[model samples]
Target: MEKLEEQIAHLTRAVDDLSDIVARQEGEIVTLNRRVHMLMQREGEREASSGGAVVLGDEKPPHY
Candidate 1:
């Protein structure tokens, strides 16, 4: 029937749109994951250099 054909066409378009959205989101996730990994690596290096000490602002006198 014509109605059925129209419904099928609409459903097809909707599916295609969703597929595009999913593809774009997947690409963004990959990029973000890479960035996060790089940041974590940098943090690890920094911590290693600092000898794992938690630096709090500038060094102060023990009496202060």
Candidate 2:
């Protein structure tokens, strides 16, 4: 029936729209993951260079 066909067409469009949204999210997730990985690497390097020093006090250093 025509009504059934119309419903099918609407559902198809909705599915396509959702697919596009999912693809965009996948790309964004990949970019965010890469940024997080780079940030972690930089943090690791910083910790290593700093020799993992622990500040005993809540006060800021005099350099601030």
Candidate 3:
């Protein structure tokens, strides 16, 4: 029937729209993951160079 056809067409379009959104989000997640990994590596290097000095929130730096 025509009504059934209309419903199917609408559902198909909705599914396609959702698929596009999911694909876009997947790419964004990949980019964010890479950035996080790079930041972690940079922080590790900084800590190593600083002689593993951990400046906690309640404490001040040695120069302070």
Estimate, for each residue in 5-42, the C-alpha lDDT of model 3 and write its tens digit. Answer: 99999999999999999999999999999999999999
Per-candidate local distance difference test: 0.94, 0.92, 0.94
List the lowest-lDDT window of 10 residues for candidate 3.
Answer: 52-61
Please give the lDDT score at residue 27 for candidate 3.
100
1-64 per-residue lDDT for model 2 (tens digits): 9999999999999999999999999999999999999999997998789887764565588899
Which predicted model would earn the best TM-score? 3
TM-score of 3: 0.86
Candidate 1 local lDDT, 4-61, one digit each (tens): 9999999999999999999999999999999999999998999899997876765686
> Which stretches of model 3 miss by more than 4 angstroms?
58-64
**TM-score (C-alpha, index-matched) for candidate 1:** 0.82
Worst 10 residues of 1 by lDDT: 52-61
TM-score of each: 0.82, 0.83, 0.86
Worst 10 residues of 2 by lDDT: 51-60
